[model samples]
Target: MIATSEISPIATLSMQISAVLVWLGLVFLTSNILHRFKQDPELVRKVVHIGTGNVLLIAWWLHFPTWLCVSAGVTFSAIALASHYISVLPMLNDVGRKTYGIFYYALSITILVALLWDRFPEYAVIGVMVMSWGDGMAALIGKRFGKHTFVHMGNKRSLEGSFAMFVTSAIVMVIILVLANGFRFRDLGVVIPVAAIAAILEAFSPGGTDNISVPLSSAFLSYLLESTL
Candidate 1:
């Protein structure tokens, strides 16, 4: 991990830009391959969605400046919105016309990154991980193996999926906190509740709004819990 004090703004900015381009290219390539093979487009979209969150981990490791992360988020959000309105990038557009979850996803990411990139960088990482691995795996598991279902906001939700989300989010939070701050039994008091709250938020969120709600809820609770403890 780069020391926070050692981060060079100019170098970090260049690295951030390059990382964005590379990540986008990978998403494009993955989308094309999935489309060509007649794979489930929604599955492909989730894979890309989950993978995209790693950029936060990369930035955190490099100790990137808050401005660069926020700028990238804004730029990406604009591109995503443009694609939605004008078909500028069809590969990234995998949802229906009525749902603005993708836009919300970008906006939520921007907000969390901006809010947590400074003193609470670990919260930012936890938020992205919950959104990525927890949410992504839930969809994948729910679609493939879900047998029992419940309704939330007019949408069918699987018990299995919610369980996956809770487990995944909790496990990822523990792992991240351990790596960044060392393992402490006391931290579980914070981690467990944050994971549970985030999972519930994702399960109940209508349309794609979970994209916004899950991370925001997770980050906020994590921040709040950490601050109090």
Candidate 2:
């Protein structure tokens, strides 16, 4: 006869591992399909970025065990680091730049999920949302429509890109706030400043560290200010 406690642990481990595999498999499969079709590398990267960050939403909605989210973050972070040295996922790392954005991105998710999952899951979602949508849009729009350019902290950025980040970040906050707290206009007090700061962090963070800075700052600021309100 087997003990229920033993069975419970086994079940949990199996579920978490399966979820991680599915999540990672989908992202990689999509990226490879896009790569096969000769799609833009940058576009494929952004798709992976946005799609990867969104797993947090599934974790949040399904109330996944904290260990699951943390483990997923750690696993992805390791894979991102490994991909840098190998052509394991060329589409993700062949962006023609020397940046650790993907690694930092996975690290940020790990940190945020570890810190905010139990106490403030909503803030975790907000953080990932801002980073994924805000930063992703900035890169895409910046590359396509960015004409007026200036250098900030050794990174060339356009007014257009910065605006995209700010606007998307603000909208992301508003949606999260309304869903989490039932649509209060006063939430703008938190949204505007957090969005502005997230943009600044994304702009100034060198070597793609904005993946860490923007999301952490956005999540913490949203939590701190929202607590006051």
Q: Would you estimate the TM-scores of all the predictions? A: 0.90, 0.88
For model 1 the local lDDT of residue 67 reads 85
What is candidate 1's lDDT per residue for 1-229, written digit by digit as tens? Answer: 8654555667766776787678868877887788778788668778678777878887888777788889989987897677668876565565444467778888888998888888888888888899988999898898898889888877777989988999999999998888789998888998789888887888898988898899888888887897789
- In the range 1-229, model 2's lDDT, one tens digit per residue, is 1223445676856765666569868987888899889988888999889888878876676566687788878988998888878876778866678677889999999999999898788899999999999999998998899999889767888889999999999998898888778989899999999999999998889888999999999999999998898
Provide the overall lDDT of each model, using Cα atoms, as 2-decimal numbers. Answer: 0.82, 0.86
Clashes of 1: 0
